[model samples]
Target: MDPKTASNLSFILNKPHDVEFKSRDLPTLSDPHDVLVAINYTGICGSDVHYWTHGAIGHYVVKEPMVLGHESAGTIVEVGSAVTTLRPGDRVALEPGYPCRRCGPCLSGKYNLCPEMRFAATPPYHGTLTGFWVSPADFCYKLPESVTLQEGALVEPLAVAVHIVRQAVVTPGQSVVVMGAGPVGLLCAAVARAFGASTVVSVDIVESKLAFAKSFCSTHTYSSQRIPAPENASNIRALAPNLAGGADVVIDASGAEPSIQTSLHVVRTGGTYVQGGMGRDEITFPIMAMCLKEVTAKGSFRYGSGDYKLAVELVASGRVDVRKLISGVVDFEDAEQAFEKVKEGEVIKILIAGPNEKKE
Candidate 1:
């Protein structure tokens, strides 16, 4: 395929465990609010990997070949006539989901829950893993001088962490316990600390991940692989003896049954618990324990209205150092290898460069 004639060069998942590069027509501005971006970097999220391995996540099945990426940042190549916020050559981080503005959830400022949301890399909606992509001008946040396109790509996951922190109502001087030490988990811990959590304890099964957490954002890290699920609460409390009784806020970014069960136990009475990760749809939950403690448990989805903006501010302000979680990066041609590394659970966060860049 001639580079000049090709409309788009994209890394697509033809099916489960099968991904390849294909040429397609260039995407045009469908709406006046649309801005065409020359993609610079895209972070491979866990959901993208799940789709590659399992062919689906819950009801969002991969019925057709779809582009595979959502965490992305790029430079604006074109802007629609009415688009005023962004211009050509402006660097931006794209918010992958476009929700219907007329929905009740949207009207109430909880647009992440909008039923008519068209999310990238979510089944029908093609993602941003391509040479060029189009997104609403409002959803594309311009990056500051200090934030690189690589760090801009991290804004998506950081937005998720911000949403989790916001939902949990993390207050100053509160004790926070974050389960799991993957990218999101680490970001959650980072956001919690940025939100003014006095003590942030990170619990994970892997020692390396725990070490990363301790160095990244966590005040302390604990290896919980050997602890029984039921004893996780007490074990976590023992690690953070500074907490009066238990964690004031427990955010389970692990989504493991044991982690979820442990969250209910570790959170102090009248404390908040936020479910930030996606594991099995069904689990053996300790319902009675939750009720007995009157824990305010809330389920966090992607992100809300101010999350992306807040995430950007957090990055630009240097309070939440997103670059700390970046373990490695690969060029566009090595996208498959990057995903493979993620599958093998070898890195914290790996970013894939755009097609214009040479493999390094």
Candidate 2:
């Protein structure tokens, strides 16, 4: 049980609802610019839970046992000789995905769209759940002294919201309607608010989530009531009376078909609509409504360059408070319990203390 000689203990998923703690080889720097991080905190993501219960998400299948976690922050335990931006003992958020630098999307700074991206907790790629994880120095965003490692773990989802809101091009004085008051939806509302949107309304079927969204970031909230998309849209518009007719931008953070359909009706003419959630690969769209409104529909994948950086800034500056979203934290020994809590709708967001985490 010596500190330095301990193996790399990882929480791995062998199949749906079948997970185990296995010791893997401690990760080492793969390049001169890579750094080895001792993960301190990790957030339970929806994708992680999906892989746990379904063993696959879309095309990404867990053909083999894969480490299960990606949203993480850790202390750099060692750095390669070429790493100058980060060093040993530095606290950083581990950006789980890295692309081939030679890709066109990468050269254009749209690495999130790169064809050959290796995203952790995704198929064929190990995640940051181990005692030690390695990542390129540039991908590991350094956290401000004021930010806790647990908060740093939130950068991943916050960056996701950042990308979605940016895709909508929300401007100051404009109104935005975000469908689905989950973590991403709630954060989308917060990010839009931070972007200076005059009114941000969060809509959801659950009254509790709507209640949380109202207090968390949104200027207004609406209950979907399982009505027709247009009726729901009209009710949502009424919540943001500052908006003329409808919202300037609409975002679907809930991949539910009804939410997606409502988003199209929620946006005003010539406004933008961004789909940030992952539902079915195919869904029916209201093409007529889109054409009539001339709405610009865009799909937001994952975060790209500057998204994570801005997410950190938004939190560090108190513009977007991620701390309010966190519901609880559990030690690494109890990581499975954290997943179960999220699966059962018991918490908003939960963080897992990394193996060997130092207790305060």
Candidate with the greatest TM-score versus the true structure:
2
- What lDDT does candidate 1 reach at residue 247? 90
After TM-score superposition, the amount by which residue 305's alpha carbon in candidate 2 deviates from its true location, in angstroms, is 0.9
How many steric clashes does model 2 contain? 0
Give per-model TM-scores.
Answer: 0.96, 0.98
Error of 1 at 79 (Å): 0.7
List the lowest-lDDT window of 10 residues for candidate 2: 1-10
Number of colliding residue pairs in each model: 0, 0
lDDT of each: 0.90, 0.90
lDDT of 1 by residue, 232-339 (tens): 678778876665477999999999998888888888888899999999878998888789889999999999999999999999999999888787889887899989
Pairs with backbone N, CA or C atoms under 3 Å apart (clashes), candidate 2: none
Error of 2 at 69 (Å): 0.4
Clashing pairs in 1: none
